[model samples]
Target: MADALTGVSRALREAPPDRVVEAADRAIRSVLGASGTAVFVADYRINGLWPVVDSRQPEVADQAGQSMVQRCFSSQQPVRDGDAGGRCRLYLPLTVWGERLGVLMVELPQEPSEEVAARAVDVAGEVAMALRAADQETDRYRRARRRERLSMAAELQWELLPGRSLSHDAFHLAGQLEPAYTVGGDHFDWSLDDDRLTVTVLNGDSIGLAAALLTAVTVNAMRNARRSGGGLVEQAELASDTVYYQHRGHRHVATVLLELDCVTGRVRAVDAGSPHLMRLRGGSVTRVALDQQLPLGMFAETRYDLQEFDLDPGDRLFVVSDGVWGADPSGRETYGQRAMARSMRATRLQPPTEAVGTVMRELQAFHADADLRDDAVVVCLDWHGSGDREGG
Candidate 1:
């Protein structure tokens, strides 16, 4: 098993970023004596999976195969099945941490033993890691994952994201944006360091390319401050100042900056504008009332203030931009007036990974299945508390 993994790692290192998938496939077949191997990546909307390397003989071409692949991706578990010819097909999720990339399909000549299955799972993880790294060097994999062309603004916004989901010992975090192909003006970002998890949600004051550019500047400015050992206040102030100076107060971003202590559940926040917060504890959902302040970049040298909150174990917190909370179809009632809470209550049983999508789907239904008039973003965080901390 170690030798096979080493071979896979060596292949990954030797291959160019755009051809890593092909290299991994050759290594897997040679080391494991597999009949065939293929990697499938989820599309931009995550609505379907596409083969990253060979498309001539795609493994998931049929509906049944697609369903099986989707099951593996969603469940984060390996699935094994045998065909009439007595060949065994193994489907393993290609996941890194909590992020679900897609699935690895391996077709063995015959039924495999438990040990072989275990090794295949390990190989899938290695492939996932390689793909994650290759993402920085080439856009090959990114192109394979997109089912449709993205608007220039959406492309920029998508490139600025950390990832759609992340997992930690103390928390599970997931987020999503709507009008996926044309999204602009709304975005979310997070970073984890030691015991601190910093999260920021932004809603741009403009639309199209202008909003994308405004958000890009603000996000990078905050990132610069955070990387320089700054806290939430510093991040917000730096971002606000940078945006104000660049646009001369003509453009702004509504934002909420938060830092959570993984060990103690203490949260410090700077609420600069929209993107309201809601907390779910036990069975009830309530708005987390934050002191409203001017949107970032609204004025030169705006001073931001910090607010505090504590997250108990099993608490679920959601940060949603105005596009969601203020969504009104055809000038009807706003979704947040009641439906957003109802949607949250309905998805209470789901994990953050699934809950984020469910809430977005509910919002779509609220819009009567029409294209959303504005960009929307939703971030969900489930605090499990620190198991290693005594009395946590």
Candidate 2:
């Protein structure tokens, strides 16, 4: 008995699920001289049994074995009996952590003995212990995989950022990122030229790694298109094409691009499957809705229209990523467009940079403790200074 216990303990410690079940079957057959040995697990959904390992009857082994194992699963106790032909039929329930996992059965050669019954019980107990350990290990591996993906995404987000605040005489732009364990595919950029500033805010799909990669590629491509120089309409056309071709075999991004003339406060933009930019004038919020274009990479043939508006002094123009508009922090209630407009109007007197920060903070509070789907960017244009300047 001591030798059997020692062997079982060692096997339980060193063997994986498959090997432990195999070893237990061998030990039971050797000890009892049983004709066949079968190990079955419980399937709660079917209210039946499932054979994990077997020694005989391949054609209908699992089916026949499940019939007996299912019965043991409910009782969680041994079903020991002798057939009419004097063949010993043993069903030893397998349990661990106060839960019935399955059962092991052994059909003895002729008649059963006390020794055979004790050994079969030992085998069932040892197998149950091994399965519990294996289950815990599998759960650990799944958690690690989830964390690894999140880490990769967070790293990508940090790399794509410009980092510091950017402000000019007419407008000041700043953004804040909520703590996210996973990668979020949201970003914004504005480049200031002599008489014009090109601003863009984007939020791609929630595809994790793939979405993060596309966001980075599209951001760089748009930067290149603007630096390469052209008309506002021309830049939008080139940027749309660049995104379509760059993500040729992959996913796409939803974007909104705005061109604001520094001298005249003239605003022209194209919206590609994104929310409208909100403009606050005289304590009232109005949406500067542009014609919708297809999301980047969806079609090679989509075109964008250039909608223009003149920016008046004290006009607060706001552009934001979807994280602000779509997120629900309290685990309920999404922060919709109306909420965002209110947030903008409330902070109209503050500097554009600080106002953007306030909006991000409010969004974080609303979401309760949940992480955002993608990065949130709020760029506010106050059209500061004299409105008399004109150029470009």
lDDT of 1 by residue, 333-353 (tens): 899989999999887888887
Off by over 4 Å in 1: 53-58, 388-392
Error of 2 at 190 (Å): 1.3
Candidate 1, after superposition: displacement of residue 113 in Å? 1.1
Query: How much lDDT does each candidate structure score?
Result: 0.90, 0.65
Backbone-clash count (model 2): 4
How close is every model to the real structure, measured as TM-score? Answer: 0.97, 0.56
Scored against the true structure, residue 189 in model 2 reaches a CA lDDT of 67
CA RMSD for every model?
A: 1.7, 22.2
